[model samples]
Target: MLIKTFENKRIGIDELTGQVISGVTFLNCDFSKVDLSETEFVDCIFYDSDRQLGCNFRSAKMKGASFKRCDLSVCAFNFVSALGLEISECKAQGADFSSASFMNVISHKSWFCSAYINKSNLAYTNFSKVNLERCELWDNRWTGANVTGASFSGSDLSGGEFNSFDWQSADFTGCDLTDSELGDLDIRTVNLEGVKVSRDQMSELASRLGINVLG
Candidate 1:
């Protein structure tokens, strides 16, 4: 059975946490500054695919908000302070996070990011110009993700599937890229400074550049 549909409602901080929400549809709702820590959403729809509308999460504190097996396609997460947000085994296709801030600003130049987005399908998600540096973003399908001017620097991106992904669209310096399929990634054209890769991955990269790594 489908649960309640929340539309244009201002949900409280203690409204939804540590509870298992399933098959609920949220449309144009305001969840700003609501503490949804450790909340589990199963098969929930945060975006109306038929109408192309999405819920608002602007400046909402979603620390440790976990979403498992949920559909967050085309959702708007602009300016959401989502530290430790876990989105495992979910489909977040076309989700817009262009203006989201994951860092707690202690100063202008000193800050840190935290988010665990693993084992999910984030294809075509919009992360343009977002700062996701030093975060745990491993083992996800990132095909056609919009990462224009975004920074994934110093992030753990191991075992990620990046088919049809643009290597030069984002800053991936100092990223852990071991055990991943680096599709069409030309090392000579992109900056791989401090980026880690396995021996076999190195061989594959070398072959792409037409350099023979004979051992």
Candidate 2:
């Protein structure tokens, strides 16, 4: 816990529990509502930080950081690497990224509920309107990702690798794409009601469920 660059520094409600902040460098820092529960930030560097409303980056590394509007709830980024991060509208609940390595990250409208991202490596991420309820993204890759209106309720994307993604209005209810790879992608107005798709993803969504494939 060695904070440098002490300008406009306001480490609010500091509790720094179980602290182990290595090589700290927080320029323009303002850790608002900071509890930092079970904190352990190795190789820490948070430039222009602004975390408010019950902040706790539990088991944090936050590699290559740039966080904005942070409100990391029940945060326990298990095995956290957080590669190339840039978070916005953050309110990550029960956050426990099982095997975390979010490469090229860019989170917008974030609120990862019940998060426990299993075997994670969300490649080229750009999660818009993110709200992964009951999340446990198994074997996640999400190549070239741009998950629009993301909301995978009861998520457990088994053996995941959704390549070339642009999942429009995404909402995979009760999600569990076993051995996942929703190929030939163009899920228009995406809202697979009670989603648990298999059988070759219902013959690749039967020609966009009979026309109107995003017009």
- Please, what are the lDDT tens digits per residue for candidate 1 over residues 1-215? 74888887888877986677888888867777777767778778787767877676767767778888777877778777777788888888888888777777789988888888998888998899888899999999999998999999999999999998999999999999999999899998899999999989999999887887777
Kindly report which residue pairs in candidate 1 clash with one another: 33-60
lDDT, residue 84, candidate 1? 77
Off by over 4 Å in 2: 1-7, 10-204, 207-215
How far out, in Å, is residue 19 in model 2? 5.6
Error of 1 at 209 (Å): 1.7
lDDT (C-alpha, whole model) for all candidates: 0.85, 0.53
TM-score of 1: 0.86
Clashing pairs in 2: none
Q: What is the lDDT of residue 141 in candidate 2?
A: 67
Candidate 2 local lDDT, 1-215, one digit each (tens)? 54444444666454454466655555444553344544555444443335422333433555444433343333334444454444433334333344444433357744334444444445645455555555566766676555566677777887778777665546777788777887555555666667776666666677666832331
